[model samples]
Target chain A: MTQPIIRLEDISKIYGSGNTEVRALLDVNLVVEPGEYCAIMGPSGSGKSTAMNVIGCLDRPTSGRYYLDGVDVAGLSDTELAHVRNRKIGFVFQQFHLLPQLTAMENVMLPMVYAGISYNERRQRAEEALTRVGLANRLSNKPTQLSGGQQQRVAIARAIVNRPVMLLADEPTGALDSQTTQEVMAIFAELNTSGITVVMVTHEPDVARLTRRIVWFRDGQVVHSHLAPSELSQTAVFS
Target chain B: MDMLESVKMAVKTLTANKMRSTLTMLGIIIGNASVITMVGVGQGAQRYASEQFESLGPNVLFIIPGSDDARSNSFDLPRNLTLEDAEAIANQVPSVEAVAAQLQTQQNVTYRNRTANTLVLGTTPEFTTVRSFDVERGRFFTDSDVQRNTRVAALGSELAEKLFGTANPIGEQIRIRNVSFQVIAVMQEKGAFLGNNQDDTVIIPLTTMSNRVTGNTSPYGTEVTVISATARDEASVNAAQFQISNLLRLRHKVTTQDDFVVRTQKDALTIVGNVTGALTLMLAAIAGISLFVGGIGIMNIMLVSVRERTQEIGLRKAIGASRQDILVQFIIEATILAAIGGVVGTAIGIGGVTLIGATTPLKAGVSTTAVILAVGVSGTIGLFFGVFPARQAAKLDPIVALRSA
Candidate 1:
């Protein structure tokens, strides 16, 4: 059987010390299988963002065995973790995080710069990625020139351009209007249909409902896990 | 990331803020320009000094009758050198090519009521050959003229023009110190050397100058002013100096601190070279301070840039740019600024040099070595000063950077 794309066992992240201490995550165990489309849901200060950071290889767990694509990465060096993030995980932030200086095509080509892809191949791949997001005619437009939904589409294109095992997005539709939110969610669904595993963090119940699974967090620990209607009978609970 | 990409990024960022970048480069430009121009001027001064000494005659030595210290102290030199001594050196010294004894006095010269205070130089016929002065018209006096005390004079090129205007002055009669003297010839133009115009003096026979013009003021056997001698070849300059010193020491009968100082052309060249070289170094050092300040300007602007672009840094780091990549990008940006400034400064400096050359007597020239060194040094300064800011940028934590943005 194929291994889970991400496996976190007994993960804990502690900040500060003594009276000033706060636990961002505590003994949280989670698994995300390949081709799974999931959403992490919680209110403000619920540690969902911290969980997303850990899963995205952008932060280290205080104590845990975290396996990504069958390789334990919790003890990896920052550079090694960055390499994994570059090749295995793609991230999209709520701010869109597109470099203002770069064009849409160049923004999509950024990840491949670190991957040591040749310039010609990068250009070809960036064009294909932009075309895939229906931004083919707007390849040279900077982020400021594109609309909110268009910028989000460009961000999505950048995240999936490297063909990572999973795309992790935090509040991907938070800054968009309802119509644009639907458009971005449709793109996510399309990407998920193409067999790309996607994990998103959001507070909107309606946004979380579109995913196949929802992992709920409160305080600093996982409180509940819900599957889609087809697998709702197998729902799990944690206290 | 590759270096090319880093350079491209640097160019893009610099171009985005063109006004700030150019303002930052101003210091470097002025610094480089001053450095190059000062060096060129210093070199020109050295060359001018050497040319002046060269016109004094090739492989020549001067035996002055006082020590440099005594001269600097403004004490009167004893009138001890005689025409006989010059003749003795010419006849006895094996290394000597020619010797000339000269006496000088400022006297009023008049031609058709055009009275001018002119320097009157008294020397033998050998003075022309020993001093490399060519008589362009008529002829110089002979030994008989010195013996018979003929009041015949040779006009220096400028003096001749002043007294005669467009008229030929070879056979004209000019009055010197109330005595009418026949102008036997006019010497060719020899230009100016060391603020003293060689073409402004009048030459007469030594005996006539001592007996008629200056009134035999010295009681010691027709005492002359300075004795100028030329060695046969370049290699014998030091030997000639040595022989002349020994001869003068023996003849003057000195026991302590011999009454005369013998100096070769090489000695003058060295002194001038050291002085001008030191001045050049001082000028360059002062100019280097500006380059340093320019570097500080770069560092300041770059630090501000890193701060302003914290969000961009975060995005780059998130996309997998290493610390070294950021560092290289910033450093390359600074180098480009400095290099561009250096190139423009070099052009400005060369223009300044050309201007000086056109307006002055000094043959100012642009040294290629100076150009290369200036540009290279400025580039290195950019790299050196760029490090602190670049390191700060490279060491920033991506999470904090993104959060601050």
Candidate 2:
């Protein structure tokens, strides 16, 4: 009877109304247990991205109850949602959005800054996180000075530096080449194996196959869920 | 988020674009510098004027035969004040220590071959005490010389040099309107007062001037141009003025409006002070307008910055930054720009004031209140103007911002 890390009960997101009504997400229900490596698979306009935004605390569901680690966060204010995201969730974008002005270590220290952590401890933890991502030597390098693979590694380090309940990534390898994509995939796998829950959103079947489970979205609802990798081989569009 | 984090982030962001930051702060810099320097110069001008007036003499008063309205309306002052009036004041007014009656007129004089027009000052021996003029060379004329109407004159410093050319002319003769007079003494350098050259004057006995150059002291008495009086002490100046006014009114038998005016040194100082103070206020106000425009400049730049850094804002928002955090960061950045600009401008302003003080007659002083107010005002302008852009940055939609760049 353990609490789920993320629980969405009847979530809906609508844009406009009447003649121009567009339902981005319609009555979607989702549950993610702790330590689960999950992938959300869909085509364009499938509402998977909308679900990711709602789950990441970057957007509010139009209607529904969202429980994050046993807390009813659906009724929370924007500031309260920001606090939850800082303490309980991490995000990695496809473009590896590391601030150009900051070094790898400073980028990793950003989340802790919002958490009200002191400078010394933030430095130590950021160093440990960069080292964990095999970028200990690149701690002082800016994003412009790093390669795509290395930049992805820094973004990953920034993501997990705060020790969140789950890591949410949107097309984490969308901008990487095949080799760097594999490298980034290996890092995600290692993080998930070390007991950090990972939720990824991607349309590539090959990328989706790498995860432990796949939840498929069609239109604005969850159409199916796969519990095993063997079931994901039947998908199309291999990279 | 904590304040230090916001400030640190702002520093990093601003330092990344040093050129843009400096250019953005230029308006504030100019505004603050002009404000400080202009106020200092204005204050210095006031001090210079007062100093000039003080050099006239301690607790001195001038009795002129013109009312305030008449003096302001025209330059043709009535020649109603007399030598007898001055003598009466010296004898009657208890607070008056000494008096000097003058009948000043321009005359062409020849000393050997050197001929020049000179300011012939018909004054008594008490002129030396009332006007604080000293005899730099030879001896001044005595009371016996004035009583006997001796044809003698004392040249001012420059007048003596012009006529004698460094040679001793104590026993030589000079001509005033064809009347010859012996040289007595050369007066000290009194410098220029009210644009009139004191060193270009020739002092002669009042009796001699009337008898030889002017005319006889007949029906209307000896008509003097102006009467200068001094008080016994600094504190008795008002008493001396009041007593002189009453005696003149009684002697003239004035039943209605008094025809003469008694002006003190303090009265002149007050008028000069008010003029300079108003000028300072006007200059400072103009500088204040520039400061306000500087704030507008800051707002413009900050708005552009917010628009340019949309993606960065999106990324920060995605990584757990609240709207308040974003707002605080941008506002702090703007304030830092203004505060730094204020400090640098203040330094430049102080330098400007110092230069003016050293090179000019104006002793420009940098007021502490002005410095503090300038810095504080610039910082506040930054904060005030920063709000709109900061709020625009904070209100950005993360999804849209992320997709734009």
Candidate 3:
């Protein structure tokens, strides 16, 4: 019932040209409504990462219409696209790309810096974001000093620092242990419940099952879309 | 990010790699120090030479015979100066305070058993006054000695000491070219001038030196070699020289080329100034080459820094740093390095110069202008050499950079 925050229509992405051309994506259509939580599942070379990059405004689709909040993304300049990414989308990577030189609090304040917030206000907001991720005491620690799970939490804090409209995570728990992965997933689910749309890419069925809905991608096209089971017993039975 | 935060980050990055940062700054430090010290040395030399030249009175002038062509080429010796010429100048020229004519010859002087090769200077009674010579004992030749052609000579202080030892030579006789002459006075110590030892000569009456010592009867009249004159003050020296030149021209009936050269103390001072100025310029230019090489070193190190910090650059960009912000950060890092190096180098340069001054006769002067120039130039070199690496760091793609690590 809610208007879709992101829309892609008949998207096709081709690499190279002439005889050497290869279709990376063929007539793929997808929509994500505001406040929705979804996971994209696919095998190797299924074009899921490419789709994620395009969706996150890190890359442009070859020949397609990508609308973010009703604005055509293909028509925007590189700088404008970056602005869109800064204002509307937050990205969480598997490797936890936090600046090693900056403290945890300073790293979280990065997006707010780009947003042109005053220094005091940026500090206050960044502290609040870190506190929300249970890192209030670790605010002064650098990325190198934190554990893998703690660093991922810091990254999540940084991603949500500006309170972006959507969070695009690509295998966010790929580098974490099972226990830490569960903790990061719990934080993601909590953020999603607070009305921030979350789109995650994962090859693990277990990780994908944690989301509310799942979209299975095969050979550059979505083959299946369904609601995940509310209980782990039913999800295990379905798998 | 705010400027303060950017600067803080820059400083933090530099301090993180202490050895690399120090090594990078070494080039700039040596460059700045070399520039300051070399220029300071050159300036000091100039000042020392100028002060020495100033010590020689400015009102002195020398008139010597022979045209420039005859002097340069060993053609024929021109005889234009005479004792009469000196008398004429002293009487006619109002600017001329005194005129002394000199005729020189080399002879063997014997005092008892000791014999030595020495210079014999034949000059008028006024020579001592005009040349600023002081008599340590007895007195100089008088007008009566010149008129009577007295075989009397004044022993220079060193020559007297060498020949007579502790004996008083005032009223003693010394043999010059086998002819015995009475030593009327002992001239005081006068140091070296133009490589010639003024204190190693003996002064005698002009007629006695020309007739007895030199044994010359020339076709030219008197055959005086040089006419030394002095003006009342510095302001009158040029006027005295002009009058002497006109007088010589009239006496020699010269129509085109001059047969004599009039040299003044001011001319000697100008020549010394020009030579020292050229030397200072040359030294500065050679030192400037080292400074330029130091700039190249800065550029090389900055390039290496950019390569080493590639991952850091990516992280910063991913964290929302703009291209300009990255550029400014790197530039600030370079500037801090050079500024610190510049201050240290300036202090080292001043210390080096002071040390040299203390150890040698060379007077080294500290120039505030050189200090400012050294610091300013180092800062500029930082800005200049930092641009390329900063641009490279700024132009990196955030996505590709983030993926690099």
Best by TM-score: 2
Whole-model Cα lDDT per candidate?
0.86, 0.89, 0.83
Candidate 1 similarity to native, TM-score: 0.86
Worst 10 residues of 2 chain B by lDDT: B214-223
Among residues 3 or more apart in sequence or in different chains, the pairs in candidate 3 whose N, CA or C atoms overlap within 3 Å are none
Give the per-residue lDDT digits (tens) of candidate 3, residues B81-169. 77788888889989989889999878899999998888889999889888788899998998788878899999988899999999888
lDDT of 2 by residue, B190-278 (tens): 88775578999999999888888887464557878889999999999999999999999998887887889888999879988999999
Chain A accuracy as TM-score for every candidate = 0.95, 0.95, 0.95
Query: Residue A69: error of model 2 in Å?
Result: 1.9
Give the Cα error of residue B40 in candidate 2, in Å: 2.3
Best-to-worst ranking by TM-score: 2, 1, 3
Model 2 ranges with Cα > 4 A deviation: A227-239, B55-58, B71-88, B102-124, B141-155, B158-165, B169-183, B191-226, B248-260
Each prediction's TM-score versus the true structure: 0.86, 0.87, 0.76
Residue ranges of candidate 1 with Cα displaced over 4 Å: A204-206, A227-239, B25-37, B51-57, B71-94, B103-122, B141-152, B170-182, B194-196, B204-225, B232-236, B251-253, B342-368
**Interface RMSD (Å) of model 3?**
2.7
